[model samples]
Target: MPIADLLDRFRPGASVYLPGATGESLALAQALAADPDRLRGVEVTSCLLPGMNGVDYAGLAPDARLTVFMLPAATRESFAQGRVRLLPLAYSAIARHIAAAAFDVAIAHVAPPDAGGRASFGIAADFSPIAWNAARQRIAIVNPHMPSMRRGSSIALAEADLVVELDGPLVEVAPARPDATARAIAGRVAALIPHGAAVQVGIGGAPAALWAALGDHRGLRLRSGLASEELLALADRGALASDGHVAGIAAGSEGFYRTLADRDLIRFADTRETHDAGRIGREERFFAANSALEVDLFGQVNLEWQGGRPVSGAGGAPDFAAAGIGSPGGRSITMLPATAKGGTISRIVARLSSPSVSLPRNLADVVVTEHGVADLRHASLDARAEALIAIADPTMRDVLAEQWRSLRTAMA
Candidate 1:
């Protein structure tokens, strides 16, 4: 049947939850333009990458309109003049919003069928699981290009109201190139990780390099949102699988995609399970490592914003940090270089660059860099500063030390 006919089968006037990235939701949004009436009350959360490339209601259909829950960068004066809608919510809550019946339909991209006839939600798993829960109708665009991840959740074909099979290339986000400073920060963070510990890291050059550096260690486990190429490489070398790697989804190079084809080491899981703080607390040797855009003397780390611009959201930071801290054998380390723009600006500041919780001071166990590690657990602001300054780049140590002393004197 044609795509239009499939839309006809579903009910109208219901809120729809679309994939944030990975093109599953973008495809549906495109098709909905053909019949604007069907999408009168549709809502979607997308990174808007697909829509940014001259897509969305206008490109899909001149008459198409929607209430889009998009990032600030995704909206424009032209979009505001139209029926576009925007909702500001943290990345972590997008799924919860949908599960609470905030949407009527869910259009998602999923991996192809597996041996047990189950499909994976490859790469991006953010709100897709939430859509799975609350949407009255579930529609999946089965893409062979998506890595067939063996994640935790298994949905029956019967549950899906519609299944659209489309062969297309998977959405790939390349890792950013890290300068010397980022490499040093990654190295410092890597030293804090002990062998045989379960790890959770986000995708980035810093985190990827940290994962690669783990080659010297034996028996490491991984638990995270987007699995990177370097991490899977560790698994291939028997460094991770020998211990255990529990991950929600896999994202990286073609080699990483092909590695996901082998299910023995990598397993896909739901957010509730993968990111459960209480469950993570129970696991011994849980080490959660995430990046920070900025850090303050008080030890608060910010990963979301830079110069007031929204960069990324708090996806699993809170959950993992809390879990790592609560875990008896685990520790949460929020890692970032001491400076920005090739030593032009200091990332370690007298106060927060802004109010963001990449790693709140209270939850942070240690902050690491090439200079050294700051053990912040139960430490006072002054003590934390001392440890952090020790890890500051040699060039910036004196400057940070003076700033720290100024703050300490004022606080006293």
Candidate 2:
């Protein structure tokens, strides 16, 4: 079906699911933003996409509501007051919640029309399929610019009610090379990574560096989220080879997508299978590497904040951590640099900023920083505090100590 004709099917107060980081259609988002009153709420995957804007409905409608999974509520600066709302949920439950008729409309992207009349969902496949089925109406911003993902589930173009065909670079988020500090932490975290483990590594600098360093290791397999450029490199270089790489999507440079086209090295799996704990726990040596905003004295991890604003979404961090630590020989490691902003912000804090993402200290086993690693499993809060402080940036040690003392006294 032609795209413009399909878009006319949507009614006001539509619960539309926008494409996430990879398949995001900026044109569609702008179109929706232009008519904010038509949308009751917009559901998004995350707010951290760089250079991409106009998705959040701030000025478009003063009364429109937004439903996001674990991202902070939108502020007036970004969105209108009372326009943003948050749905607190674990990554595991996001699909189920959406599938149960949680939204009225959904927005996504599809590949160019194929001979079979089926177009792939491209890279952002996690909860999208679930939402697409649940929405009363579905709108797809068809883009030939996106690499036609040969893997994962395919969506039938004949079924969608709205389709907008446009050609432009879908938003690209390139993984950054870790700095010296992050590299040191990644190395310590990598030391704990064992062979034949099904691992889930989070996005950003530390995981990218860890992916590069894993070149020396062999026989490591992945049974987690999407395969990034560094991970595909490991498979290509023979450092890491999965019996099969299981994931819902893939995001990286043009080179990364090219490597994914290789049938032998990459095979995409549905989220129901990839993120399921029962399925992942069967793997013998599961390992997960994730980032953190701050690790408190008692080993809590907050991956959702920056300068008091929520910069990330609650992705598969908790799900992968639980599966990795619960596996027979699995290990879950949280890696982070000791500080941010050139010594102004301490990555290790006495307390989490309001709105905690990862709670329950026992869930995480190892926390790594530039200075060293802190194994927090089965340890007391006081003991965990000591170990966490030990690995914090040296320059911030005194400040942490003072903060810790105050917190301790307050608890007393």
Question: On residues 1-412, what C-alpha lDDT tens digit does candidate 2 reach at each position?
Answer: 5534644544455555665555567666666566555544333333223322335654356545555554423333443354555555666776667677556667667777678988777766776777777777777667886666666666888888766787666655577778887788778877888766666887778888888877778888777676776776687688766466677767776556655654445556556677787678777889988888788887778876676666555677777888877888887788888888878888888887747656457686889988998988877877788888899988888888888888888898
lDDT of 1: 0.66
Give the alpha-carbon lDDT of every model: 0.66, 0.69
lDDT of 1 by residue, 275-382 (tens): 778888898888888777787778888866778755455667778888899988789888777777877887777678675455667786888765668899988767
Could you give the C-alpha RMSD of every candidate to the true structure, in order shown? 3.8, 3.3
Q: Kindly give the stretch of ten consecutive residues in candidate 2 with the minimal lDDT sum.
A: 45-54
Best by TM-score: 2
Q: Show the colliding residue pairs in model 1.
A: 15-104, 150-268, 151-268, 152-268, 152-269, 221-244, 372-391
**Model 2, global lDDT:** 0.69
Work out the TM-score per prediction. 0.84, 0.86
